[model samples]
Target: MSTQQPENTAPADRKVILVTGASSGIGAAIAARLVTEGHLVVAGARRTDRLRELATSTTEEAARSGGALEPVRLDVTDRADVAAFVQGARDRHGRVDVLINNAGVMPLSRLDSLLVDEWDRMIDVNVRGLLHGIAAALPVFTAQGSGHLVTVASIGAHEVVPTAAVYCGTKYAAWAITEGLRQEVDPSIRVTTISPGVVDSELAHTITEAGAAEAMRSYRAHAMGPDAIAAAVSYALAQPADIDVNEIVVRPARQR
Candidate 1:
C-alpha cells in the first residue's frame, strides 16, 4: 500500500459527504461535525432560511479548518430532487464518499386519533425518503466500488410504545431496509444504521396529537443533544475501510 498522493486527486483523508435534512437538529450537527473534521459537507434541507444560516456558520468555521459546506434546498419526499442533489454533489466534487439519509418525520399519535395525514407524512418522509436516498446513492457507490450509507433511525425501531405506532413502523422499516441493503451490497460499500434514543430535537415539534405532544415534553426532560448522534455518525465514518460498523444505538444516560 502506497501513501502516495496523486497530482490531481484530493487527499485520501478528505471525503465529499452528502447529508439530507440538514437545516437543523441531528442533520445540522452532523454537517458541522463533519466540516470540523475536515470533510467537505453538502447539506440538503427544505428550509432555505435555516440552511442559509447554517451555511454562514459553516463558512466561518470552514475558513479556519479549510473544509467547506454547500447548502441546497431539498425535500426528501421528492424523489427527483433527491437524485439531483446527489448528482450535483458528484458533479461538483467528482465523487461522493458518503450519503447520510437523515431526513425524517415523527408525528406521533394514538391510532384512535386517526391522524391519517400525519401517518402519510411519516411514511413519505421516513420510509419513502430513505428509499429515495438509497436509490440515488447506490448506483454511485457501486460505480466507485466504495461509499458509505448512513441512516438516522430511532430507538423506536427496536421497541414499541404508546402513541408512536406509526412512527415506530417507519423506523422499523428504515432499519430493516438499511440492514437489507448492507447484506445485499458489496462489502466494500458500507452501510450503517444509527438509532438514537430521545434526542433533544425539532422532531417533537411536529407532533400534532395534543396528548402525544405533552407526553414528549415530559419524555424529553433528560434527552441528549443532537450532537451526541452526530458524534456517533462521525465514529462510524472514521472507521477503516474494511471495518464496517453495521449499527449503533445511542441514548441519554437517564433514558430508560
Candidate 2:
C-alpha cells in the first residue's frame, strides 16, 4: 500500500470563523476585526443588505490584510436556517474553526409595562438563538476534534437591574448555557462567553417602554463603542488552542 501525504497545504495562519448577527454593532465589529487579522469570516444576519455592505467594505481591507469576509442570511432562532448557515460555511471553507454566537436583542421594560412581546423576543433571540448556534456547530467541532464557541452575552448576565429583568434573565441563561457546554464538550473544544457593559449599538433603539427608554438614555450616556467588545473577542480568539479563555467582561471606565 502506498502512503499518501495530506493534500491540502494552505498556510495554517488563518482560521475559518463564523459570526452571527453581523449586520451591525459588536457582531459587525468582530467580523471586521477578524477579517482584518487574516481570518476568513463568514458573517450572517437577518439584514442581508447590511451583510453585503459589510462584505463590500471588507473586500478592500482584505487586499491589505490577506483575509476576507463572506455574507449569509441567517436568523439564529430558526433551527434549519442556522444549520444551513453552518453547513454552507463548511461547504465553502472546508471546516468551521470557530462559531461566534453574537446575535442578541435587548428591549428593556419594567414589570409593570408588561411588554410581553418584547420579553418573548428576548428569550427567542438571546436564549434560543444561542442554543441554535451551539446545536449547529457542536457536531462539527466534535468531528474535527478542535473548535471554539464564542458567546456574546452582556453584563446583564451578571446582575439584574430595574426595567431589565426579562433581558437579564435571558443573558443569565446564556452565561449558564455556555458554561454548561464548556463542561460537557471535549477538552479540545473551547467555549468562551463575553459579557459587555453598555456599548453604543442599535440594541438601545429597540427599546419602546417609556420609563426604560428614558433610563437607557442616561445609562448609555457614556457607553463604550462596539469596537471595544470586538477587541476582547480578538484577544480570546488569538490565544493558543491549549489556553481557553473562559470568560471576558468588558465595560467602560466611567460606567459604574
Candidate 3:
C-alpha cells in the first residue's frame, strides 16, 4: 500500500483526471477505475450524494493505490461551471492530465412526438456539454503542452434507430466534435471517443415516451455492464503518450 502524497504533489505515474456526469453508470465506473489505477480522479455531477457515496466506496482502494477521489457538484450545461471545474483541478494539482466528457442525457422519442424539451435536453447535455468541456480544458492542455480528452459517446453516433433521431444527432455531434479536436490539436494533446453499445445505465430512465421506454427495455436485455466501458477507457489511457487512440467502439457480443 502507498501512502497519500500532499494535495499539491502527484507521483510521476499518477495522473490528474477529471470526469463529468460521475454520479452513476459509466461515469462512476470510469472514475473508480482510474482511481484504482493510482490516478487522482475528480468526479463531478449534479448529484452530490451519489458522488459522496462513490468517494466513500473507493476510499480503501484509493488509499492503497495512492489515488484520491474528489467529488464536486457540477452541471455540465453551464460553461462557467465547467471552466471552474477544470481550473479548480489545475489549481489543486498543478496540472490536469485528462478530461473525460461523459455527461449526457437520452430521452428517446419520435420526431413527430414534438418533445422539443427532451430534444433540447439531449443537445444541451450531449453536444453543448462536450463543447463546454473542450472549451474549459483545451487551453489548460495547450498551456501544459500535453493532455488527453476522452468523450464517452454512444454507438448511436454511428447509427440511428427508431425514436433515437434526436439522441443520435447529439451523439453524432459529440463524435464529430471530438474528431475535429483530434485533427486540430497538436500531437502532444491526445483525443479519444469511446462509443458504447447498450451498456447498463440510467440514461434510459430519462425517456418519458412510453413507447420508446418500452422499446429500450427490450433492447437493453443483452446490455453490458458499465465496467465493460470502463475497461475501454482504461485501455485508451494506458497507451503510450506517443500513441493516440482515435476512437474505440465497445459493444456486447450479443448486440447485433
Candidate 4:
C-alpha cells in the first residue's frame, strides 16, 4: 500500500482519524470534513487514484487548519489489510483517536431475483467489513482507554423496502453490531452509528438488476448531498467526552 505524509504536522488538539472506503461519497466527505476540522485524517480506499485526488483537493484547507490528509491504499474486506491499516496509523501517530468504518456496498435486488453473488458481496463488504474494523480497532481502543468508533450505516437498518431485502439485512446487522459494541465497551471508548437515507452516492450504481436500478433512480431523485451525512458525523464527534451520541438518522426532507 502507498502512504504519503502531510507537509505540516498537526496541531496539539488535532486527532489521528482513520476513514475506510474514503475514495468517494459519504466516506470521502467525512474525511474531508474531519481534515478541515484540524484532524490528521488517514483516508483509505481500494481506489488509490481517487484517494490521491481527494488529498489534492483538500490540501490547502488541511494546511490552513493545521490538519493533514494521508491517502492509503486499503481494502476493508481483507482482515490483515485492516489490521495493518490501523497499526500503521498507530505506529506513525503514537495513538489513533477515531476510526470511521464507512466501507459498504448496496446492490439492491429482490430475493427471488437470486443474485446470490451480489448478496454475498453485500455481506462481505457490509457485515464482515464492519466486524473486521471492530476486530482491528477494539484492541487498540481498549489499550488506549480512549477512542471512538463510528459506523456509517444506512436508513435501511430501520426499514425494509422492495429490492432491498439483502441490503437492509446487512445494514441492520451493522446497526446491531455497533449497538452491541456500545453496550459491551467501556465508557471511555465511544461508539456511534450514523444512518443516512436517500443520499446522492454511487451505491445505487452497484445495482445490477435492471428493475432495481430503475427504481433507485426515482428513489434518489430528491436525494441530499453526501456532505449532510458528513455533518452528522462531525456533530457526533464534536460532543464532549461525557456525551455518547448513540445513533443519528439523516435523510432528505422529501425522503419519507
Which lDDT tens digits does candidate 1 get at residues 60-167? 567656678888999999999999999999998899999999999998999999999999999999999999999999999999999999999999999999999999
> Which parts of model 3 have CA positions greater than 4 angstroms off?
1-11
Give TM per candidate: 0.95, 0.95, 0.96, 0.96
Which portions of model 4 miss their true places by more than 4 Å? 1-11
Per-residue lDDT of candidate 3, residues 193-247 (tens digit):
9999999999999999999999999999999999999999999999999999999
Q: What is the lDDT of candidate 4?
A: 0.94
Name the 10 consecutive residues with the lowest summed lDDT in model 2.
3-12
Return the clash pairs for model 3, or none.
Answer: none
Question: What would the per-residue lDDT of candidate 2 be over residues 204-250, giving only the tens digit for each residue?
Answer: 99999888999999999999999999999999998988999999999
Q: What TM-score does structure 2 among the candidates reach? A: 0.95
lDDT of 4 at 183: 99
Model 2 regions more than 4 Å off: 1-11
Pick by lDDT: 2 or 3, better one: 3
Clashes of each: 0, 0, 0, 0
Looking at model 4, report the run of 10 residues with the lowest lDDT sum. 2-11
Runs off by more than 4 Å, candidate 1 = 1-12
